[model samples]
Target chain A: MTVTPDQVLDCSGLACPMPILKTKKAIDSLQIGQILKMTATDPGSKSDIDAWTKKTGHELISYEQAGARYIFYIKKTK
Target chain B: MGETSKRLAIIAAHGSLDAAYPPFILATAAVAMEMECAIFFTFFGLEILKKGYADKLKIAPIGNPAMPVSIPNIVGVLPGMTSMATGMMNGWMRKAHVAKVSELLNIALESGVRFIGCQMTMDVMGYKKEDLIDGIEIGGAASFLEFAGENAITMAF
Candidate 1:
């Protein structure tokens, strides 16, 4: 299924908690079914975002590494 | 489902005044992110939320091995020493761009962070509801756990 884009959050170079915090702020501004594209450079971003998505009940549509950057697609679930 | 908002819960159980700073700092930062934040104060941590003791809180250096050797332990054992050290530390923090505990607490409250006092601890310490700061909610561990469960982040200090 195709997901609709809602917002994009570029969080590269941000350390632990900042990325998560910014992603959260972005998600809060979006409505249900909207998707967010998040990019970050923190080594812990992958696991932190994944865990955050799980705990917050958000849907992590996709995640992949592009060179040194980690990109994630998250959907507002609840 | 609607957008899942980030929420956080911080449990502060330390009796030492300096130790209380971490929980408030994290809570205030969480508030800055506009996340729903709650601080659960338990045990000696309740002192900071007590109206009578809050402003008089002092940083205890006794038994703290990391204490600078320049400050003699004997001096630390003297009356008013902890308060003097706390005041000096507060001044240094202000110079170093670090936020004070009271400032952080105020910011956290203004930013919508919930502050809760542990009911069990209050009873054990003989504190009535009037003894606590205004707007402080009284609850037990189960209540805090319920709030923490819905939060994406949980911290203990």
Candidate 2:
């Protein structure tokens, strides 16, 4: 499948809380309805992003595992 | 849901001297985000909310394998050492511009963050309402469970 990006956030090698923190910052800078593509290597990224999106009312478009990294596509809801 | 507000509850259970930082840091962060935050102090965690105990608490190195070798492992065993260490640590934090426990508590209060003391813990510790600091609401686990319900983020520190 083809992936189109609106914004890219590389959060590899970051620890717990930081990945979420950076993601929030990235999403905050974008306009509503704009997409955010985040790449993280933290093992907790998958669950953290999942929980964060659920809690923050954001939409998770897709999540893919690439080699040792995890990538996510998200849309700003608020 | 049409609400834009964030609500969180931090369960402070570790009565360790240094363990107080988790709830304080997280609560302060919540306040920074303009979120409604609450800290429920249970068991030994209530020590931090005491009038003078917050300034008198210390991080015990006993049973802590991660402690540096220069610091004596038995420092916690010595009487008054905990208070001394707590004082020193507080001073260092001040020098480093880190927020004080009292400051954080005040900030939480000012930001409208609720502070709840665990009734069961207070009973176990032989403390009364007057034994704790002012402005604390006494409640049981069920109360906190209710407060943590309905999508509110809950964390045990």
Candidate 3:
């Protein structure tokens, strides 16, 4: 719960591919094991991020919801 | 799980505003998921590749009952209904902060989504290669299928 991110991406208000797209870009800029904290308003990010992490071999460290926002902590694995 | 990156082959056959978003959106998202993606734009779908057309593409409400505002078919057939419906849809997309189709195109191209303008369709439609945005390949059905044949996941929109 106290983990800090290497980068924070604010994808609030963006829809569909934007959230996942921005999350991927942010994760790409990190070295292995670095964490990206991305926040988005798109409700679809839950499934999308899960699928993306599964497919891309990235690690979904954790995620939580705050009101209307979905926040994810993703770690770069490759 | 595999050594080769999976491929996605998409056939985009419709040119309406509603039709245009799927291929690019899916393509970009697929690319983000580390899939090798290509979209073959054919028939009316070519409208999406035309310069300056994506943002201006209109959705005709005349035959679309799914119009968010639910205008009756009679009113939908009226002269201004297409633009009205398109405007309302654009408003909704904007209100939800959806990226414009044009922006999606940029993302697709930048994310390495291969855009294949169907050469046969292009010849039939009389569209020159110069009319499309840069970094696109014009190929025929055989070429598209060649890529699609390589363990690629294919879809249409």
Candidate 4:
């Protein structure tokens, strides 16, 4: 499925905990059911974001890797 | 707001620059995971809460063999070794895009991660509430345990 995000956040060049922190802050501004497209350069973000999605009950529509950037399509739930 | 069921409780017992990152990083990450988080600063860890202390924290290389640059114990004990070690680590962190400890501390506070200063430690150290950054609640072990409660993942740094 092609998921279009309602908002985009760039966490490039930030290390662990920062991408997650910024992602949380950005997602907080979006409405429930809206999607956030987050791009991160940290390699650890793959597992971290998945774990965050699982713990927070947010939906991870899809994730892609473009060169050094890891892109995530996240949908806010509740 | 109805939050998640998980929680994180951190006991920060060290104040050295190398030892300071874990609690703040874990607490903030736990918050982003939608978990309740609190950090209790005791003993040396209380130094992290002092206003303007982050910039001055030092990493002693003598005891730390894993420092990016290995130094002989004798050499590491020389004057200014701690300063040099701290500077080198700071440079590495900057290159790695890691946020400063001060910045992480602010993120934790702004994100609602609870910070509890040990009241007895403050008393022993002659630290007044004004000596610490604002928004931290002063309390003792019992107070922190009360906040940690049950079912929270507990860790110490």
Top candidate when judged by lDDT against the true structure: 4
lDDT by residue (tens digit), candidate 2, A1-78: 366767999988765545676687788889999999999988878998887787777899899999989999989888
User: Estimated TM-score per prediction?
Assistant: 0.62, 0.61, 0.95, 0.95
Docking outcome class, model 1: incorrect
In model 2, which regions exceed 4 Å deviation? A1-78, B1-5, B72-84
Residue B1 local lDDT, model 2 = 58
Q: lDDT tens digits, residues B64-107, model 4? A: 87886788899998999989989999999999999999999998
Model 1 Cα lDDT, one tens digit per residue, B1-157: 6566588888899867678778876775566454778989999999898875654667766666675435777777998877777777667655644545666676667668889899999889999999887877899988788888884588788
TM-scores, chain A, per candidate: 0.93, 0.94, 0.97, 0.95
Question: Candidate 2: DockQ?
Answer: 0.04
In candidate 1 the C-alpha lDDT for residue B116 amounts to 88
Give the per-residue lDDT of model 2 (tens digit) for B80-140.
7656655666676666445567766775676577899999888898888888888889998
- For model 3, the DockQ equals 0.91
Give the least accurate 10-residue stretch of model 1 chain B, judged by summed lDDT: B92-101
Could you give the CAPRI-style class of model 2?
incorrect
lDDT of each: 0.78, 0.77, 0.90, 0.91
Which of the predicted structures, 2 or 4, would earn the higher lDDT when compared with the native? 4
Best by DockQ: 3
lDDT of 1 at B68: 48
For model 3, residues B64-133, the per-residue Cα lDDT tens digits are 7776677888888789888988898899889989899999999999889888899888888899999988
Interface RMSD of 2: 7.1
> What lDDT is reached at residue B145 by model 3?
95
Backbone clashes, candidate 2: 0
